[model samples]
Target: MGELFQEAILVSILAGMIRIATPILFAAIGELVTQRAGIWNMGVEGTMLMGAFTAYFIATATGSVWLAVLAAMIAGALVGLIIAFMTVTMRVDHFITGLGINLLVAGLTLYWFRMYIKGRAQPTFDGFDNVAIPGLSAIPFIGEILFDQRLLTYMAFAAVPAVWYLLYRTRWGLELRCLGENPKALDIKGLSVSARQYAAVLFGSVMTGLGGGFLMLGFSDRFLADITAGRGWLAIVALIAGNWMPRGVLAAVLVFALLESVATHVQVLGIDVPHQIFLALPYLASILLLMGLRRQSRQPQRLGIPYFR
Candidate 1:
């Protein structure tokens, strides 16, 4: 009985880790593409917040989770367009533009949420249900952890390899990657640098929006102000810690997710320490990871630099 209980707890923790990693994984992999195209979007947090808010509003209002998901993507695209306009078209400093975006979204979402719920009880909706893969989900321990998850969770994990292929294999991907290392090379080839950067930023924001929606739909029925917490910033940290590679980003996200999952299970494990310590584990780990890996960074040379014709 004791052994079975321990095994069950272990499986639960691992399953939780995968679920927790979903949102961050989605954002990190998408942002990896954005950064590789030379745009250092600092507004990921704000974009995510906006997406969450949009998803919440739509889900409650429309009674359709799918519509909410779509709305969130739209919200992200709008935010991405703003980032692109400032950083790519207006030639503003990327850092400044991203910071401005974060601030703007934070303020805007707060106001909108307040007005939305004024004089009314908070609304709620049903979140996504896990879909177990037929044969795969029936496997002993591995199936429960990997094969039984929300549809979006599978999509999020699959995105890592898809992104890897896009970044390393295809022609358009090669051009996109070139935008980070040498936009001038594309320019010399008579390619439109702004176009590719805009596409990259848009794609990242859309995925980020989807992640936000997933966080709301897959995890909670109702929305709260700043519901994304600092996951967006964590995603950024994961990217840097992973040296902007897809596999590395996934690993970093898993580390953070595992820490969070462990935190959630501390009480069940009969640990006596303060819960706050467990809650802080992922952020603390992120700081240490960044410090240790900074020296080994393989960041793109032209990243965050505005391109000029």
Candidate 2:
């Protein structure tokens, strides 16, 4: 009985780690694309909040998770457009533009959320159900941890490799990468630098939005203000610590997720320590990891510098 209980706890923790990874993983992977193209979008947190809010509103209003997801992607795209316009067209400082967007989104979402629930009880909706892969899901310990998850969870993992291929193997990717390393090179070749950057920013925002949508539809029943917490910031840190590589980003996200899972399980296990400490583990780890890894970062040379001409 003791051994069985231990195995169950282990499985639960690992499973929770994967589940927790989904949202940040999506954001990190998508941000990877944006960064590689030289746009350092700092509005990931606000964009994610908007996505979650959009998903929650659509899900509750229409009772359709898929529709909510679509809506979230749309919201993300709109945010991306704003970021692109500021950084690419208006030549605003990328950091300031991103921070401004974050502030704008935070306030906008709060006001909308308040109005949404005003004079009415908070609404809730059914979230996604896990789809256990046959044969794969039936295997021993590894199966459940790896194969039984919501559809979006599987998509998030798959996105790492897909993004890798897009970044490293494709022609469009080469041009996009050139935008980061040498926007002038693309300009000299008569390529449209601004167009590609806009696409990249939009892609990242849409994915971040999808991650937010999943954070809502895949986990929570209702929305709350600041529902995204700091996962968006974590995604940015993962990109830095991972040196902007897909595999490395995935590794960083998993580490953070594992810490979060441990934090979550601590309450269940009734550890005598303060839950706040556990809750702070991922952020603490992020600070430590960034300190160690920033020196090794292979960041784009032109990243965050607004391109001209």
Candidate 3:
């Protein structure tokens, strides 16, 4: 009985990891897309907060969660466009611009929240349901572990295939690579460098925004002050650890999620583990992953260097 209990507990731990990974997976893949195009947009935390706030507000006002999701994506795209124009077209310093955008988004969300919510601590969400695949749900332990999740979680899972296809199989993908690698060369070949970068940045930001909304509507069922809690930074690190590939990022996200989920469970279940040490697990893993892998991956030579070409 003791042995079986430990086995069940281990299975539960794995399940919890997958559950926590849902949002990080989305954000990491989105940042992966951004970095692949030679841009590092670090404002993901703020964008996520906005997404969360927007999703909750729209859901509350209209009682339509779908609309809230749509709104969050649209809002994210608009913000992405703004960043693209500044960083991609204007040739501004990418790091400074990204940092500025993050601060702007964070302040704006908080300001609007106070103005609209009348200083309420948080806005609530009815959120989405945990959906299960028909035949897939019945396949022993692995089935429930893999198949049952919220719609956003499923969407995050499905996105891996789509992202891989878009980045690897498409002609547009080649152009994006060329733009990041040698924008001047692309310009000489008559390809529009800024146009491609703009698209990539905006697309990346939209994914990030959806990730934020996912936290609010899909996971937390509410919005609170500064609720992103540095998860955006984690997403950025996951992108690096994955070497900016969709498939790799999925694994990276799962690993980090497991660390966090383990920490949360140990803390909540009164497992007698040092709370501080466990709480630091995910972050420590990210740092180690970055240190270990960065030496192996060679980023685009022109990355974050404004592309006038």
Clash counts for the predictions, in order: 0, 0, 0
TM-score of each: 0.95, 0.96, 0.93
All candidates in order of TM-score, best leading:
2, 1, 3
Model 3 ranges off by over 4 Å = 1-8, 119-123
Give one digit per residue, the lDDT tens place, for model 2 in 1-309: 133258888899899999999999989998999999999999999899999999999999999999999999999999999999999999899899989998999999989988999969899999999999999999999999999999999999999999999989999989988888999999999989999999999999999999999999998998888789989999998888788889999998998898788777777777766767766776777688778876776899999998877
Candidate 1, residues 82-138, lDDT tens digits: the string is: 999999999899899988999999999889988999968999998899999999999
For residue 154, what is the lDDT in candidate 3? 83
Each model's RMSD to truth, in Å? 2.0, 1.9, 2.3
> Per-residue CA lDDT of candidate 3, range 39-155, in tens?
767777767777778887898888899898888888888878877877887877877787888899888887877787785665565887878889997888887778777878888
* Ranking of candidates on lDDT, top first: 1, 2, 3
Which regions of candidate 1 are displaced past 4 Å? 1-5, 267-270
lDDT of 2: 0.91
Q: What is each predicted model's overall lDDT from 0 to 1?
A: 0.91, 0.91, 0.77
Question: Measured by TM-score, how close is model 1 to the native structure?
Answer: 0.95
Model 1 clash pairs are none
Candidate 1 lDDT trough over 10 residues, lowest sum: 1-10
